[model samples]
Target: MKKETFSRVFPFALFMLFIGLEEFARFLQGKDILQVGTHAIYWIYPVKAVAVGAVLIFFRKHYREMRLGDLGRPTQTVASLLVGLGVFWLWVNMDWSFGTQGAPSGFNPNVFDDTSRTGMTAVRLAGAVLVVPVMEELFWRSFLLRYIIDGKFSRVPIGTFSWASFLATVVLFGLEHNYFLAGMMAGAAFNLLLYYTRSISQCILAHAVANLALGIYVLQTGQWRFW
Candidate 1:
């Protein structure tokens, strides 16, 4: 194969490998295989971030580099604002969906109990703000959506929207979360960011900001039901 073809395929293959390894490890360990919550934020989350960063570095020539400044587009700003409102509206609409479980009976409130000595809360916060945004944006926005349009990802326009790719990814993303509605909204918003700014970094930043705000709100309001 040509060097360009190899470059295009390698990062995506590595991403799939990383995801499979993480999931298989989790299955074998019967819990979070990385033990992310047990380790300090500086140690665990940063290591995961480094792994993602390394992949980007290795594929720097093939992959597009996105930066925060790229998000200055008016459409991107509007989309980001709409994302926030959409999430809040989804929360309100799904209030009954959460039910009245409460505490340890049906749901464990300790997950959001930041006062606890366990590092789970911190780990979750770090993952949301740092790790998740990078990996997810790379996969969902930069790779899968473009890959759906054509094999040559670099040549594919960033804002290209395919109904098939959007729905498929949104469903997959939703299944990853306990709050299905919230996850669906998140997936849509991230895709919209890519569509508006034509920058994966903008989607990454928007995702991180949304998750960080949601995390803080969950802690403050004792809305562990969302978790």
Candidate 2:
């Protein structure tokens, strides 16, 4: 892969690697081949977050689309916030039968005592809100969307649209989540946001807003499945 591709793909790949490891460990635990408790798997989230977060920071300079100046006007900021909140509302409601793959064994901090649970919940929420959005937007919108447009993805301007790229990205993004329909809806929304603003920072902000709202909702409703 080119340096550009490596810069964009590595952190997200690392994040997914950790997730795969967690799943494999869970499989072993299920079969009684691994003696570790489920809480041990929970640690993978923060570990991945930190590992990927560090990589993102290291390659921060390479992400031209994420520059501080590209945050857009006040109007665009408001639009991002509104769209984000709207997506969050739709996401929780759209957990219909066909959309769900299975009952998600989501992050449950309740397994720990009060202090550890509190810390674990905080870390999970922080990873969801802050780290995930940036990592995902970089992979999905900034890289794959353009990469599909052209192998030399950096030559393609950010938010350049083609039906093939758009449809493929939306489907792949949906498959990345348990709630496939909701994920597609969000992916489309964010794709359109990129089309409108041509700003990855706004997309990140929108994603962060949606995640923050979902995190709060999960905490309040005790809906660990959403986490």
Candidate 3:
């Protein structure tokens, strides 16, 4: 393998491993270590985003050499808008399946009562709207999905569709959300954005839009169950 390939793939691997370890630690502790007090959950959002962002940036040269922009090809402004709408529609229409089945059951709503919850919520919402999109799109769309098709990932034509890659990424993505089908759908939608515009940015934007919408809806409606 080329040095560039190794460099690019290494940090990507490390980021995934770091996330896995962090999440496992949180699970083992049976609490959000990043949560401040009882009702605040955003304290760790920046840490998480910065950690991953640093990894991606450290490998920035290699990532750029990999032709990341190609993945965002055939860009269409309308496609982005449509994706946003489609995601919203899915969330609205699939309430029975995604709402109940995908919703968290164990957390107390009072967790957000603490004054710290405001800062945490704002921080987390910012990460969702800003940091998460770039981090995830680079990993899922620009890297793993394409890497699954070929070790020389950049050579794996943009907009290329492969069932194996699609399903594998979706499964991994779903697993990250505790195997929820709603998470699976979210993963699938991100992939679809890649399919439509061949742009990783579009996927990121769509995801950010979806999450932002959900976050606002949850806050406005006091539906902490969805959080």
Top candidate (lDDT): 2
**Per-residue error at 196 for model 2, in Å?**
0.3
lDDT value for candidate 3? Answer: 0.65
Off by over 4 Å in 1: 1-63, 88-120
lDDT of 1 at 226: 55
Query: What is the C-alpha RMSD, rounded to one decimal, of candidate 1?
Result: 6.0
Q: Which stretches of candidate 3 lie over 4 Å from their true place?
A: 1-42, 65-75, 92-115
TM-score per model over all chains: 0.64, 0.97, 0.71
Which 10 successive residues of model 1 have the least lDDT summed?
99-108
For candidate 1, lDDT tens digit of each residue in 1-227? Answer: 55545554455456556545544554545555445532222233334545655665676666454666776777776676667556655654555555322221112335334554246566557766776666677767777778778877668877789898888777766655556666776787778767777788777777777777777777787775554
Ranking by TM-score: 2, 3, 1
Model 2 gets an lDDT of 0.91
Clashing pairs in 1: none
**Among these predicted structures, which one has the highest TM-score?**
2
